[model samples]
Target: MHIKEGGITSPRIEPRFEQLESSLKPQIAPADASWKRATLTRQPRFNNVVARNWRGELPLWVSYWVIGFIGNLLIGIIPVAVDGTLSGHGYDPRILLITLAGGWLAIAAVSVWQGVGVWRSADARIIARKDLGRAAPWAILAKLAVFVGLVRLIALAVNIGAPQMTELSRMAFFDDPDISPYALRIMRNGTELEISGGFKFGLNEDLVRLLRAAPKVRIVHLDSTGGRIGEAVTVYNTIQERKLITYVSHQCMSACTVAFVGGQQRWLYSRAQLGFHAPTFPGISAGELADATEEQREIFSAVGIDRSFVDKALSTPNNSIWLPPEDELLRSRVITNVSDGSNFAASGFGANLPRDTLAAQLKKSLAALSDLERVAPDEFNSLVDDFLEGYQKGQTEAHLLAQGRQRFLRIISTNLPLADDPTLIDFGKLMIDQYTFLNQRDPSLCYQYAAKGELDPFLLSPTLREREAALDQRVLQTAAKRPTIPAQILQSLWGKVISAVTLRVGRDNAHMILGTKVSPAQYGSYCEATIAFYQEIIRLREPEAAELMRQVLAPK
Candidate 1:
């Protein structure tokens, strides 16, 4: 408690009061010697203590960098964890935003705490005071750099791993049901089977199982908006292998058209729509996309569709659907028939009659007519003469048959009158045979009938008609002695003649004709002959025949 000043001694005093008085006393030193004097007098050990303390704590820039990096890392990881927890469970997007914001605010609070620590640190305060504002700005910049670098690292990691993680999360949290999109139902009293809806992965297996269970199915009706191409190809192969007829009464798009093109006999309703497009897969690699495209092209080519059609389908972008016009459908031979739904309910094989019994009756009637043609040639000739005379006056084979049918029915009613009598069948066969013979004897008769717009070509079953058409084309191409009429013109005339007959007799009546189903080949033979004869008359420059041919050949 003694005081000494300027090399002189002071008197001693009470220790506690003297200590307080000494603590309040002030001392001054030269500016050059201030640091040394303070270091020596104000406890020189304090500098070492402060240095040791600051050594345990980090430098301000280092501390800020570490804090910012950790804060940003927490900000990144928290959101990712929250996202994984709630992913694929249909959580609102705002939940993720809120979680990220909360984490960022926490990081910012930590940064502010770190800044306060730097402001309070004895060494940092002294250094900051000496360096003016440079120290704080440099520390802030270092922290900002560390924060940005950590955030970018998190973003890179997330970008690289998000897809796989998302897929795994979805599988774990939102597994889908294993239900098929397609449904198969037997229709038209089990003669036809209707397949509806999208073509899912396992639809082909379902379709094949249904088909195996229903062996009687001859027609497959399609109603779909398309789906997996692999399943569609399987269905197409099954349908083609079975030789089943395919009918589209509604929308058939994308892969659905693949199955449609595989039909043994394809048919379309007037209002039905069929669309096509190239295959596509999102998020697939370039090589994988190329492979898929090639596979699709192969499938289309294997179906034997026109190359142009295949090209159009392939060239169309995957996002868009190409619905070709009806004329293109017909020209491409994509459909063998176009229906208006009128015959759909009743046009299946033998839908309107007992098939086996009708076949037997028709065979018997055909035999009886042949016997009559041989045994009573004179009576047959007289009946034919009367038919021809009636036909010439009425200008229609149906009219001629109607006039002769009553007389023939009256003649047979007395001899073989029974509830199941074959009289009508026999009479119809006789009328058809008479017409066939007359057409053969006079090549001009077809022209005359065609001129009057009354050419009545016989109807044939789809199978028989397609076969005959193929044979006709082959014969035309390879025949050593070609007909005077070109093959194209002959085909054109044949199509017109058949169309006219179809319009005249009505589709239902034409389908109901026993000859059409029972003896389709024979019916087709007569039609081909009639077409040839009509073409010959047209070549000979008959004005009425030429005019009628022009009208028939014009685009419908």
Candidate 2:
């Protein structure tokens, strides 16, 4: 089998055309038949119009449009053919096109079906299933074709079908227990979660169902204008698992308010309202129980808030809790954003005001209120009486009130085993109450007049006046940071009033003392707090004397 120089080594060659010619010997050709040329074409695996388009046969879209248009043309011509008339826009163009294409495809499909039927019926040529080799390649090819057709389907029906399924999921905040619809997907953005429909029964169950269905969902509570306490608690439990954020777009009252406070992120709107009173069950009664007892910090942490933010929220009540502007909410981690609404900012009348502003205003107003309580004796007493009346109602009116004032008093009286550190003033709350009653009855008695030297009339060991004076004295001592002479001069007195410093009394009378200083805002800054007097003598910080202040303020 080795090839030498020019010798030809050949393999066998046979004429394969003769075998097919021998097999078709019975078929006769007509004398006039010109030998027809035959060619093999590769029919595409995917034949449907949309399917072909999906397989990169994008021209089919134009074809579909054209065919639909032609179909519409046919429909439009129908009236002309039948009654010599034309159709207008009233005719559905889409339906006409689909109908026409469908009819054409149906006819073509029938022709192919009949030919296949004739081939299968030929007795001698009927191929056995096994002989066709366990389902032809064409069968697998058909499955692939069907898949392509399904994915590439462009009919209005298929497009229309999808949105109907998605509509249910779009409403994540909405709850409806009456019907078992799909749950929505959501997250805790600084975004608002608004619920459209009003409240209905079984809302708690609906919310529970939602959480169970989508455990990973982040939380957002929009304007929940109060709701069932029991239901709110259940919803809160669901939210606590992830420490989900809860928001009150404006007002979250009663049960909902409790839930908001429990949130990892607490929020308030500029226009938001927070109503008091305990959380309650709807249509059911329970023993009188307080709403929330633990400190604000613990509640926030238990619900997943980072601890640092809880500190700020609790510390600044009106700022972070009540009238917290949106910016502070973000800084304090109470809320992430305003989402969409009038931002949380203070306004005139001061109802919806910023925290710092509120604090300053409160200090001024309270100072005034305290003075009015002393000066216009009757008017001041009535004002205090009004405060006490409101305080009493707020603490006792509702069965489920937090009752801070009462609880504080109880702790002071040692009637309550818990709450070791009650506010210091609780010991004389009764005395204050008596004063309130007297003021309400008479309205014009000065506090000293009301006391009328009976300050300790009960034969108590220490006289009431003596006790009051002792407390007042202690207060004054605490209020003074340094002795009247000034801290720098405390050790050098040598038992004598110095001649270098004159001990002269000011015009504020020999009794009263005052301090004054330059403005804080100007370049030459100072304030009244820097100057003071002690023991009827005018005393001032040497460095900030009148001449020095004049120089600091001069044309600065």
Candidate 3:
């Protein structure tokens, strides 16, 4: 409808229509240009499945950023907090199982919804980039998140579905016991309460009840390898409140020390041990572990342990143990005194325990040394006192054994001024052999003999008597067979047997009767001579006849 020319056509047109066309043309051109610009700037419609349900751009964006990220994080944190609270207080197993089930279910539902929303939102962004040819930096990151989310979902499902697999994973990571085999005992006829083994859950409650029952228990003996810190802390509070003295018999390790240091007067047996190391828990963050370690530091510090020593103890790795010597323990004030293990019943080889516990075994091994007290009372007492110190300094039983042997040798040497090392060694060996034989035969015999200060060989089953009885029985049996040797030669061989056997027996008996009065050097010489004499007899006689005599007269 353009007015062609300012000639005949323009003169005939209506003035109003011409005026309207001119005015509308200017507005139309601007509106078309503005529409094109807006189209290019606008975001594309979401292309994934969630777009069908969501129906608008705002819903998709809100679900992706708000519900997917923030909401999921909140959900994840709730369960962890709940679990920590429940576990820390030693809640029932069933309650924990129920919490895990509900928490996982809520997490799973929300996570699936979030994944779908995120998928549609990311698709829209990718589409917008393709249509407009503009950069979409979030597209790559969203794609990576989608893949990772799927992997995490699969892992979560599998882990939650299989309890054994979850437990295995936990064990591999934490390396801790699920349940401790802890024990509690009323020892010393109700005067002592012994807490042994691990410091398991509910052990503190056990302590409270036991203390209530045994009002006479003024001492708490700790012998443990460690367990739950929560249990240990509770037990510590109980001990402190009761004003009970704490003692370690065999070992007080890790969490056990927490309770041990709570004593009104902390003490450890001379040979007892206190082991330390950092605490461990599975699935805890570095920050949480640091906090837990700080708690342990505070616990020891509260009890007046040296700060440097506490640092050393807590810095030790969970897999390893740091056992400080008794002097260090005393210097750090970790113990009030080092005991000789006399006050506690665990020092004795009491009922309902294995023979391998070092304290009990040490007591048993040292019991035989009482025999030496009869001959050298001053030396014996000094020797035992030194051994107690050595034991406190962390010496092994074998080390103590060697130390005792050397001390015994010195004592014998001092008594026999002319005796040499070889002679003293022979005397030592004889004493050891006889004591071992007698102890093995009947432990009561030596114990009673030593207790009564009776050195009468006639009352005891001497080694010589057993050997002679064996020889006589063996000889009588051989004589009954009427061997086909000439009577004169047989009689001669029998006499030699008598002489050799008597020489060995007499030498052994004399040493026992007059220890340090007779020369120890003579016993070994006589034994060697007896063996040589038999060899000579064997060489001169017929092989078969010589074998019979050899069997009867061989040195035991």
Candidate 4:
């Protein structure tokens, strides 16, 4: 119906019901019209734009999640785990950790960059609403991955900042074989157990048994170049458990240091040294080596060594060693105190060995005997055999030394060429008589002569010639006037003879014979007095000494 207007005679205007009705009815478009709309005339769908952008970015997303993050993580963690699991070993590959840390930073940058790109380009809400129905789980996974990546970054920080912590954690998973002990020279003196030699397999058990049998043992003396780490550990445990002191009078190296640190009180004599180096197992992987090295590193650390020092020690190659100065060792807490081992007796064969065994032992132990053996093997062997016989028949070291001296002097006499000349014979006889007389007073003087090479035939031969020529001149002159000569004349003649005999023998030798040091200023007068006394004895005892006197003073 139309509303009435003010103008009369106007046709009744009504609302156009037909146009409204037709507009409301569904209108079908031409097929070509729809095709034209889709292909050429349509505005862009914002949701579809997002889906396309995301599809284009799929490669980077795959790289970030699959290759960069997950791949790198597996590369770092899997080997450590697998090696530790399969071989019961672990190691810190510093180079590998550094490389992985670099990769983590790179991947983290890519992840952030790619995320901002997606945020700026794609409408994630629209994309999910339209097409992500089946991929809803992937969206949740992305959130979880972000959280995991954050956790990994934190761990990487810990690895870089506190490497020792990481190393300790890695070491905890391994259960390595214990180092077995090797045989060594072990000696017991009172309450001390002295161990000397390389530590090898079987030492632990041996030491354990020794300690068991000797519970009163209070000190463990170690002289070693190291050996089995396990054996050292055994000693360390024993020392710690017993609350015993550890002493080093000579040298303790490598694994020996491990045992030494276990002592409640560690001792290193002034001349002694402690050596250290990284632990090694033959044919082990680098990772395993690091694990083994960590064992000692932790041990040293527990004993209050500086971390840097331990690191350097463990980093050193096993083929070489680190012998820290005694002062440095004390500063580093490697030892508790400086000791000279004065309160303790030095290690030696304290057992009462059989005669033959003692002789062999002395032969090997004495430098003088070794020298004699080198110079005269047969004489040395015969002397040693005689020593054995005498010792079996009860002879002391001093007595044996005396007998050896006598035999040595006899050897020099037998080898001398004195029999061809009467003058040479007399000179030789004089030396023998002098030695025999002095030896009756102090047998050690004979040993001193042998030791000092004072009776060396080669050295004495020229001197004897000089003495012989002097004696020949004096004896001829004395023989011309002696038998009926005045007392002063006889005394003067004998003085000249004695001077020739004692001249090359020297005042030092004369004092040595007397076993006292006469002053240099008084040496000449003292020597003359000694010579005069011996001369009178010779003159009174033997007419053979005065045969020249008898033969020449007679008138035919």
lDDT of 1 by residue, 520-541 (tens): 3344344434444334334433
Query: Taking the tens digit of each residue's C-alpha lDDT, what string does model 4 give over 334-446?
Result: 88888543445343222233556655676664444554555567887887778666533433334554676677545433423222234333643565554444454444443
Best by lDDT: 3
- The lDDT for every candidate, in the order shown, is 0.51, 0.34, 0.58, 0.53
Which of the predicted structures, 1 or 4, would earn the higher TM-score when compared with the native?
Answer: 4
Model 1 Cα displacement at 423 (Å)? Answer: 51
lDDT of 2 by residue, 1-556 (tens): 0001111111222111111123335457444423333212345666774343334342322323333244335534432332221123212223323443343343334323322222222211222223534333332333333334334332322333233223222222243332222222222221222221223334545655656666654545544444444344555555665576665545554445445655665555444554434332211112222223223345556645556655443344221334445565466554544433223211121122344454354335334333333333455444344434432222211211123223322222232111111111221332344344334433323132222312212222234434433433232222212213353543243112222223343332212212232122311111111111111012333322322222221231
Give the poorly placed runs of model 1, Cα more than 4 Å off.
1-180, 343-556
List model 3 lDDT by residue over 1-556, tens digit each.
0111111000111111011122345545655777888986775566664444243243434555555555456555756665675666452333444555556565656565566555666667666565655655565465456567767666645634345235434433443366446677776567877777777665787788988898999988787878877678889989988889998877888889999999989988877899999987543446557877998899899989999999999999999999999999999999998776444554322223442344334435544344445555677667767665554443433455567656754454334322222332333334344444445555444433322323334333556445433332233222222324566766777667556555656645423322333233443433343333444444443543344443432332
Judge candidate 2 against the unseen true structure and give its global Cα lDDT, from 0 to 1: 0.34
Candidate 4, overall lDDT?
0.53
Which RMSD values do the candidates have, in order?
A: 23.8, 24.8, 19.0, 22.2
| Candidate 1 to truth, TM | 0.34
Q: How many pairs in model 2 have backbone atoms within 3 A of each other, for residues 3 or more apart or on separate chains, i.e. clashes?
A: 4
Model 3 misplaced stretches (Cα beyond 4 Å): 1-58, 76-110, 123-141, 149-180, 347-351, 354-556
Q: List runs of model 4 lying over 4 Å from the truth.
A: 1-181, 184-190, 196-202, 249-251, 268-273, 282-295, 304-315, 323-367, 374-556
Distance (Å) between predicted and true CA of 507, model 2?
A: 56
